[model samples]
Target: MDKFNRKSIVLLVGLALLLALPPITIAMEEAYFISLFSRIMIYALAAVSLDLILGYAGMASLGHGAFLGVGAYAVGILAFHVTEETAIPFLPGGWAGSINAVISWGSAIVVSSLFALVIGALSLRTSGVYFIMITLAFAQMLFFFFVSLTTYGGEDGINLDQRSQIPGLDLADDASFYYVCLALLLAFVYICYRIVNSRFGMVMRGCKQNETRMRALGYSTYRYKLICFVIAGAGAGLAGALIANQSEFVGPGLMHWTRSGEVMIMVILGGMGTIFGPIFGAVALLLMEEVLAAYTEHWMIILGPVLIFVVLFARRGIYGFLTGDGGRDG
Candidate 1:
C-alpha cells in the first residue's frame, strides 16, 4: 500500500481496537472524567477551526469564542422550551424538541457565520495587530451583550433541566455522549483532511504564507480569508452546540476572551500548523487540568509555567517536538 493508505489503515485499526475494548462505563464517582474529556474535545474542535483560519488562511480572530457561545446558547435556549412543546418551536411547526435541537444548531451556524462575515469584512480592512484588535473588539461586544442580558443566565449560567433527547436514540448517558463526541471528532478530522488537500484550502494556505504574493497572483486573498473565517466560525458554533448538549448547560463564560486564549494555547501546544496537532494539544491540556486539579485547587499555578516552557522550548508544540519534520505526515 502507498504511505497514505497505510496510515489510514493504521488509524482504522486503532479505532477498531478502541471499539473492541470491553465497554467500560465511568462509575458515578468517576463520571466527571468522561465529561471533562467531552468538554476538551469540543474545545479542541473549536481550536482546530481557528487553526484553519489563523494558521492556514492568514486571519486573526479574537471573537471565535463568541461563535461558540452562540452555539451553546442556541442549544440551551431551545432545549429550554423543547420539553414544554410537544413539537419544537425553533423550527416552523414540525421540527421541535430533538428536531429543534438540530434546527437551533443550524441557526447557530448561520448566525455565527453572518457575524463572522461582518467581522471579517471590517477586520480585513486592517492588517497585523490591528486585525487582531478588531476581532477582539467584536468579541468584547458580544461578551458584554451576553453579560447584560437579564434573562438566560446573564453574568451567571444555568443548567439544562434534562439532556435533550435524540429522536430514536439515548445519547444522554455519559458513555454514549463520549462516543458521540468521538464520532464527531473523527468526522471533523476527516473533513479537515479533505479541506487541506483540496484546491480551495491550498489557496487559503497560500494567503497565510504571503497574502501579497497571492494577490499578485491575481487572487483576492481577502475574499478567501473571509470565506475561511465564516467556515471556521460555523464550525466553532457547532462545537459549542455539542458542548451545551453534553452538559445540558450554557454560560457566557464560554465567549470570554480568556476562553479564546485557551483555545489558541491548545492549538499551539498541539501543533498549530498540522491538521491533527490540535487534538493532541487539547487532550494533553485537559488531562493536565484534570490530573493536576486533583492534587491542588490552584491548578493554573502549575499549568501556567508549563505552557510557557513548552512555548519557549518546543516552539512548534508537542507534535513538532515528536515529529521534527513538522510537515504533514498523515
Candidate 2:
C-alpha cells in the first residue's frame, strides 16, 4: 500500500513537471528543451510500446524498429507526392500526397499494424534466440529495402516541407507540438495500463511466465501474443509519425537494428512490465546522452558504466527504485 502511494505520487509529480516544462524552459530561455523533450516523449511512446511485448509478453523483438520506419515512410511518401504534385502510379484513382495529419498519420498507424501482422505471423512461429535472430534479420531486410529506394533519397532519406496539420493546432510551434505529444503519450500510457490489467493482459503475462501451462490449459498463446504485438506496433507507428514531424525528416536509419536495441535498452532500463517506468527510462537515457554529449565525444563510454550500474544494482530501474516496488506490473 505504501509502495503504491509512493509510485502514484512520483507518477503524478513527473506528469506535472512534463506539463509545466514549456513555461519553465521558456522562463530560463532554454526553449530548445521543448524540442528535446518532445523528442524524448516520442521515443518514450515507442519504448512503452516495446515494453508491451518485451516486458509483459516475454517477446524479444529485435525488428520492432521496422514498424516505426514503415510509419515514417508513410508520412514521407504521401508528403512527397504532395510536394511534387504527383499521384502514386501503382494505385488507381490518382491518389496523391497529403499533409493532413489524419490521413498521413492514420495511414501510418494502419500500415504499421499491417506490417506487424505479417511479421508477427511468421516471427511468432519461433522462440528463444531464434526469435531474436529472425527479428533482427527482418529489420535488416527492411533497412536495406529502404536504402534501395533511391526516390526517397535512398540512404539519405526524405524530408518534410512542413509538419502535419492538426485541427486548430499549430504543430509548427514547439510548445504546441510538445503538448500534443504529451497528450498522446498520456493517452497511450493509459491504454497500456488498462491493457496490462485486463483479462487479455493476464493471459499474455501468463504466457510469458509459463507457455506450456497456458497451452495445456487450451489457451492459444500465439494469438494473444500476436494481438499484443499488433497493438504495440500501432503505438510505435504513431511515435514514428511524430518523429517524422518533429525532425522534419525520415531516414532508413529509423529501421536499423541498432535503433531497436536502443528502444529495448529504454524498456529494460526503465523497468520492464511496468507501464510508466519506460517513460522515465526514456527521459533518463536521452537526458544522459544530451548532457554527456556536451561534455565529451566519448559519451557512450561514460553511459556504459551508468547503464551497468542501473542493471546491476537498481534492478527495478529508476521508477521501481523510487517507488520501492518490484518491477512487474502486478
Candidate 3:
C-alpha cells in the first residue's frame, strides 16, 4: 500500500477502536470507560508537554505535576466562587472569555500558562541535577500551599458540582465526554506535530542537542527553553482541568512529586522523544496497573520488576523495538 493509504487505514482503525471501547467494556459502564479515557488523554497531553522539554529539548524536570495541579485547582476554585452558569473558565484576571465552557476554561488555560512561565523562568537558570531539584522544590511548594488552603480542600480535595458543559452538548453523557477527550488528544498531538516541524521547533531541538552550539549559532537557548516550558505547563494544566471535570473533583494529590514521576515514567516507558511514545506509555502503564490489580492485591510487587526490566532491556522503549526512529522522518 502507498504510505498515504497505510496511514489513513491506521487512523481509521484507531478511531474504530476508540468508538468500540465503550460498548466493549460492558462489565464497566460506558461512563467508566469515558472516565478512563479522559484520564488517559489528559495524562497523555501532560506527557507530550514534558517530552517537548525533556525529550526534544534535553531539559529534565521533576516538578511537572505542579502545572497540572495548578490548572485543576484553578477550575475547582473558580467553580466555587463564580457563577454556577456553566460558563467557560477565564484567563487569569479575566483575560479571555467563554472558551468551550466559556469563561471558566479560558481562565484555566491562562492560569496554567502564567504559572508555567514563572516556574520555567526561575528553573531554567539551573542545569543538570540542580534544575531537577529546583523544579521539584517549586512543585512541592505549590503542593503544600494548596494543602494548606483549608477552604478549598486542604489535604483532601474539592468536587465539581458539575462537569464543564460543552457549548451545545451535554458533556455529562459518557459517549460525548469520551469523544471530547479523544478530540483534544488528537488536537494537542497535532499542535506538537506542527511545533516540532516549524522554524521555532528546529531551534528548540537544536538547543536540546547542544546549548553552547546553538548559542554560538546566535540562538537564545533560554528563550527557547522558556517557551517550551510554558507549552509543557499548559499541556499539564489542560490535563488537570480534564481530571477535575472527569472526577468532578480536584485535590493536592495530583501535584505531588510522585505524580510528576508517573508522567516521567510514562514518557520513558513509551519511548522518550517519539511522538507516539508518551501516549503509548500512558496506556500501557495504566492498563498494566488495571490488569495486575485485578489479579492480585500486591500488584506493585510485579509492577516494580516489570518496569526495571523495561528500563534495562527495552532501553529504546516499545516504539524502538517496533519502529526504528531513524527509519522515519520527523
Candidate 4:
C-alpha cells in the first residue's frame, strides 16, 4: 500500500479503538474512563480548532480558549433562563421555556464567531508578539467580565440542573455523551480536512508562506485570516458546548490564559498543521497527566522535562514521529 493508504488505515484503526472504549470500560466496570475519555475528546476538539489557525494559517492566537468559554456560557446562560422560566435578559423574545441542545450549540457557535471576528479584525493588523498579546488581552477581558457577573455565580461558576434535551438521546448518560463527543470530533476532523485542502485553504497557506507576495498579488490576507479565525472559533465553541454539558457546569476559568496555553501546547505537541495530530496530542498529554498525577503531586515537574525532551528530539511530535511526517511542510 502507498504511504497515504497506510496512514489512513492507521487512523481508522485508532478511531476504531476509541469507539470501542465505552464497551470495554463497561465490561471492566470502570465507568470513570468514559468521563475521562469524553473530556479528552472535548479538549481534542478545541485543540483541533486551534490547529487550523495556529498551524495552517500561521495565526498564533493566545486567547483561543475564550471561544470555548463563550460557547459554554452561551449554553449555560440559556439553560439558566430555561430553568428559571424567564425570558433571556436583554433579548426581545419571551421566556425560552424548553432548552434544546441544538439551539444551544448553534448559539454557542454564533456567539463565539462574533467574538472571534471582533478580536481577529483588530489583532490581524498586528503580527508576531503584538498579535499574541492583543489576543491574550481580549481573552482576559472576557474572563474578568464573566467573573464579575455575579448572577451566573461569578467565580463560583454556574451549574446545569440537567443536560439539554436532545430529542431521543439521553445526554445525561456518560456513555451516550461520550459517543456524542466522539462523533462530533470525527465530523470536525473531516470538515477541517476538507477545509485544509480547499481553494481558500490554499490561499490561506500562501499568505502564511509569504504574506508580502500574496498582498503584491492582490490577495487580501487580512480577510482570509479573519474568516479562518471565525471558523476556528466556531469549532472551539462547539467543543465548549459539549464540555459544558459533559461537566454540567460553565465558568470563566474556561477562558483563562492557562487553558489557552494548554490547547496551544496540544497543537504543538501533536504536530502543528497536521489534521489528526492534535487528537493524538490531547490523548497523550491528558493520559500522561493522569498517570503522573497518580504517582506524584507535582506532576508538571516531571511532565515539563519530558515535553522539552520530545520537542528537542522528536521535533515532529508523537504523531509526526509515528507517521514519519515530522510536520516539516507544516
Candidate 5:
C-alpha cells in the first residue's frame, strides 16, 4: 500500500509536469526542451513496447529496432512517393503516396506488426541465448538490407519532405507535435497497464516463470507470446513513425542491432516488468546524455559507470527505487 501510494504520487507529479512543460519552457525561454522531451517521449513509447515482452513475457528481443525502422520506412516511403508524384513500384495502378498521418502511421503499425509476426514466429521457436542471438541476427539482416537501398539514400538515409498531416492541427509546430507524442505515450502506457492486469497478462507472467507449468495447464504459451510480440511491434512501429517526424529523417541505422541494445539498456535501467518503468528510464538516460554530452564527448565514460551502478545496486531500476519496491522484477 505504501509503495502504491508512493508510485501514485510520482505518477501524478510527473503527468502534471509533462502537461505544463511546453508553456514552462516557453516562459523560461528554453523552448528547445520541448523538442528534446518530444524525442524522449517517443523513445519512452518504444521502451514501453519492449517492456510488454521483455518484462512480462520474458522475451528479450534484440531485433526490436527492426520494427521501428520498418515503421519509419513505411512513413518515409509513402511521403517520398507522394512528394515525387510517382506510383509505388510494387503496388498496382496509381497507388502513389499519402501525407495523411492516419494512413501513413497506420501503415507503419500494420507493416511492423506483420514483420514482427514473421520474425516472432521463427525466433520464438528457440529459447534462452538462441532466441537472443537469432533476434540480433535478424536485426542485422534488416540493417544491411536497408543499407543496400541506394535509392532511399541507403547508409546515408532519406529526409522527410514535411510532417504528416492531421486535420485541424499543424504538426509542424514543435509544441503540437510534443503534445501528440505525449498523448500517444500515455495511451500506450494505459493499454499496457490494462494488458498486464488481464488474464492474458497472468498467462504471460506464468510462462515467464515456468513455461513447462503453463503448457501442462493447457495454455498455448507460444500463441499468447506471439500475440504479445505482435502488439509490442505495433507500438514500436508507432514510435518509429513519431521519431521520423521528430527527426525529419529515416535511415537503416534506425534498425541497427546497437540501437536495440540501447533500448534494452533503457528497459533495464528503468525497471523490467513494470509498464511505467521504461518511461522513467528513457527520460533519465536521454537527459543524462543531453546534459553530459554538452560537458564533454567522453560522456559514455561517465554513463558506463552510472549504468553499472544501477545494474549492480538498484536492479529494479529508477521506478522501482522511487516506488520503494524491493522485488527484482516490477
Candidate 6:
C-alpha cells in the first residue's frame, strides 16, 4: 500500500480503538482509564494548536497556556456566578448560567483570541528569544492576575459542582464524556489538517521558510502570523474549556510556564509541522507520565532521556518515525 493508504488505515484503526474504549472499560470495570484518555484528548488538542504556530508559523510562543487558562476561567467564573445566584455584572442582560457549554466555551475562545491579538501585535515586532520571553511574560502576568482574584479561590483554584451540560448529554458519566472529548478531538484535528493544507497555510509556511522573501513578494507576513496566532489561541481555549469540564476545576496553574513548556515539548516531540504528530506526542508523553508515575515518583528523570533520544535520533518525532517520513517538513 502507499504511504497515504497506510496512514489512513492507521488513523482509522486508532479512531476505532478509541470508539471502542467505553464498552471495553465497562467490561473491565476500569472507568478511570476513560477519564485518563479524555484528559489526553484535551491536551492533544492544545498541542495541536501549539503546532499551528510553533511548527508551521515558526512562532515559538511560550504563553500559549494563557489562552487555555482564559478558557477554563471563562467556564469557572460563569459557573461560580450561577452557583452564587448572581448575575454577571459586566454582561448586559446580566447573563448567568450554571452549565451553558456553548456560552462558556464561546467566551473562552473570544477572550483568548482578544488576548492573542493584543499580545501578538506587540510581540510580533520582535523575533527570536525576545518574542518567546515576551509571550512568557504576558502569560505569567495573567497567571498572577488570576492568582490574585480571591473571589475565585485564587491560587487554590475553583471547582465546579458539576460538568457543564450539553443539551441531553450526561457529561458527569466518564464514558459519555470520553466520547465527547474524542469527537471534539477528531474535529479539531480535521480542522487543523484543513488549515495546514489550504492557501492560508501555504502563506504561513512560506513565511516560516523565508519571511524576507515572502515580504518582498508582497505578502504581509506579520498580519498572517498574527492571524495564525489568534487562531492557535482560540484552539487552545477550546481545549481549555474541555479540560475544565473534564476536571471540574480551574486555577492559575493552568497558565503556568511549565504547562506551556509541556505543550511545546509535545509539538516538538511529535514532529514539528506535522498535523497529526502532536497528538502522537501528547499520548506518548502523558501515557508515559501516568505509567511511570505509578512505578516511581521521579518519572521525569526517565522521560528526560527518552525525549533526548527522540530529539537526537528521531528528529521528526514519533509520527514521522512511524510513517517513515523522518526529517521532512510535514
Better of 2 and 5 by lDDT: 5
User: What would the TM-scores of all predictions be?
Assistant: 0.86, 0.98, 0.88, 0.97, 0.98, 0.97
Best by lDDT: 5
Candidate 6 per-residue lDDT over residues 140-171, each given as its tens digit: 99999999988889998889998988899899
Name the lDDT of candidate 4. Answer: 0.90
| lDDT per residue (tens digit) for residues 1-330 in model 5 | 887899899889989999999999999999999999999999999999999999999999998999989999999999989988899897788899898999999999999999999999999999999999998899899999999988778998879989999999999999999999999999999999999889999999998889999999999899999999999999999999999999999999989998998788889899889898999999999999999999999998998998899889886899889888857542
**Each prediction's number of clashing residue pairs:** 1, 0, 20, 0, 0, 0
Q: Which one wins by TM-score: 3 or 6?
A: 6
In candidate 1, clashing pairs total 1
Poorest 10 consecutive residues by lDDT, candidate 5 = 321-330
Candidate 2 residue spans exceeding 4 A from truth: 327-330
Residues 1-330, model 3: lDDT tens digits:
454565455446756877677677655544566567767877888888888888878789999999989988877877765533443344355532222464566667788999999999999999999999999999999999999988777998787778877778888876677777777777888898789889988888888777898999998889988998898888888878877887888999988999999999888887777656787788777777777898998887986887787778776566555444422322
Q: Which scores greater on TM-score, model 4 or model 5?
A: 5
State the C-alpha lDDT per candidate. Answer: 0.75, 0.92, 0.79, 0.90, 0.93, 0.89
Q: Write the per-residue lDDT of candidate 4 for residues 156-245, one digit (tens) a residue.
A: 888999987789999989999999999999999999999988999988888778889989999989999999999999999999999899
Candidate 1 residue pairs that clash: 88-96
Over 1-330, each residue of candidate 2 has an lDDT whose tens digit, in order, gives 877789889999999999999999999999999999999999999999999998899999998899989899999989888998999776699999799999999999999999999899899999989999998898899999999989888999998899999899999999999999999999999999999899999999998999999999999999999999999999999999999999999999999999999898888788888888899999998999999999998998987887888888887788788888865543
Residue 8 displacement (Å), model 2? 0.9
Question: How does candidate 6 fare on TM-score?
Answer: 0.97
Error of 6 at 77 (Å): 0.4
